[model samples]
Target: MSAVAGKAAERVAQEVPAVQFRPKKIRTVAYASAALLVVVFAVVGWLLGDTPTGVIFRTSDQIAMALLGVVLAGAVLLLARPRVRADAEGVEVRNPVTSYKFAWADVLKVSFPDGAPWARLEFPEDEYVSIMAVQAVDREHAVAAVRALRELHKAATR
Candidate 1:
């Protein structure tokens, strides 16, 4: 490349910041789901075990119920894992299968939903993106990311 062209390229590269990934940690969903599973298991166990007609339920049946309880608990814990990250360049929202990258300029809005396990973002194109991983497990982290992103946006503009 010519020296002038190379210098121009270097200048452009320096102007655009690099992306930094800050993963979202959402704990509430994970813990709450496990709790719900435990409650269900307890109710089922009581009905299946100590009831007066106990002979009908049997020990083997209880074991099967316990196994089901375990599976439910595991599911809840897995669902509670965080999946959101953000950095200097932009925000990255990830679900189990898909991930989207939005630069500070593209992010139009960030909304924290009440009684929901994820945060949603609206883009300039009018499409919606979910930062569910973080919302599911660490909402405070998600909020902090949004705040950080706002600052990043301001810096980029200036």
Candidate 2:
């Protein structure tokens, strides 16, 4: 019984799970977009005041509310909200724009380059996907994620 328990503990210690990655700070594009949203809202407020975008007597309160909706929508897009996960069987990448799950068997290559926000993967059919969710945020975390993913890929190939 003790031998079995000891083996289980060793296996548990050996297995390391993969984690998601994201940008450390807001992306440059996101900042620019946010700024643009604010500017447009400001301009609209100035030009169409107290009329609810054309009427009259809207007051500052209504104008502020109208601008708030625009800001909220902009924030949602610029954030690039997404998640990435990997396991022995496969990897799942998700975001507001796209989501995909791939078995290790389908993956052919993984690479990370300098100046890139994240890693990327190549597969059969000449298809490719960004590993941004895995490598965008930090160097240490990204490397770890890559190494872990490589292991899974190799296993799947076998």
Candidate 3:
């Protein structure tokens, strides 16, 4: 590369600011899900133990129900976690199943286009990556996040 091109790339790489976004609703949902799981397990245990024809609940069964509640709550909490972090070098997206890192130069656009379930980055090879942290349920907050990402992308490219 030419000296001018290298210096320009260096400047772009150094000047872009870092930003992170995460959904606000996830915390509320996670807590509610955990509480609901516990309640459901307790109700089921009580109902089974109380019914005349139902098999008597053993102490071990109660313990198992408690464990099941805890496991379900943990799974719900895990599913709710999503985060996005972007800096001069690249953007890192963490969703429930996997995470991805994409350099600024490779991301052509950042958008939460109409009808899209979440924010997404338009990249090379006709690829689009989801930013699950910016959810549609959050509405305006999600829009603001997408705008911020677009600005960051433009700054890094320039």
Candidate 4:
């Protein structure tokens, strides 16, 4: 390659910034709701009296109920786990229960369709990976993340 072309390529590579993205509104809501659920459940368990059939509610039963609430809160907190990391080399997308990593060559584009819940990384053969971290509820933040990822993909592929 020509010297100017090499310099331009180097510049482009240097311009690619590493980024980590996470849903703002969803994460905040998830944390708040989880905390609230745990508190409510624990309070109810502690104050629980007897059953309608006159069966007494034992301390063990109360403890078990509190534990159940903790478990449920943990499950609810999973909604905040989605994240995306991207750089010039590739991107990593982590949804609630699944994760995907793709090199620039494997990613054809970054798209956020109208009325979609989140952004996505397009691949060959019409395949794509959803990026839940960049959620529609985040609005401008999601748009900026998608644009940054697209720019990184372009620079890497070029």
Q: Pick the candidate with the highest lDDT.
A: 4
TM-score: the better of candidates 1 and 3: 3
Predicted model with the maximum TM-score: 4
lDDT of each residue in 18-128, candidate 3, tens digit only: 788888787688889888998898777656556677567787787788778878888888757889998766789999788999977889999777888788989878889
Clashes of 2: 3
Q: What TM-score should be assigned to candidate 3?
A: 0.83
Give the residue spans of candidate 2 off by over 4 A: 1-18, 27-78
Rank the candidate models, highest TM-score first: 4, 3, 2, 1
Candidate 4 residue-wise lDDT, 1-158, digit = tens:
68966685567668887889999999899999889888988888888765577778999888888888899889989999999998766899999999988877788899999999999998889988899999999989998998888888888778
lDDT of 1 by residue, 1-158 (tens): 58965565455446544433333343555677777877788678667877776468877787777678878888767654435555444567766557787765577766666876666777666688876654534556656755655555555434
Against the reference, the lDDT scores of all candidates come to: 0.62, 0.66, 0.82, 0.87
TM-score for predicted model 4 compared with the true structure = 0.89
What RMSD does each model have against the real structure? 6.0, 6.4, 2.9, 3.3
Candidate 4 colliding pairs, count: 0
| lDDT head-to-head 1 vs 2, winner | 2
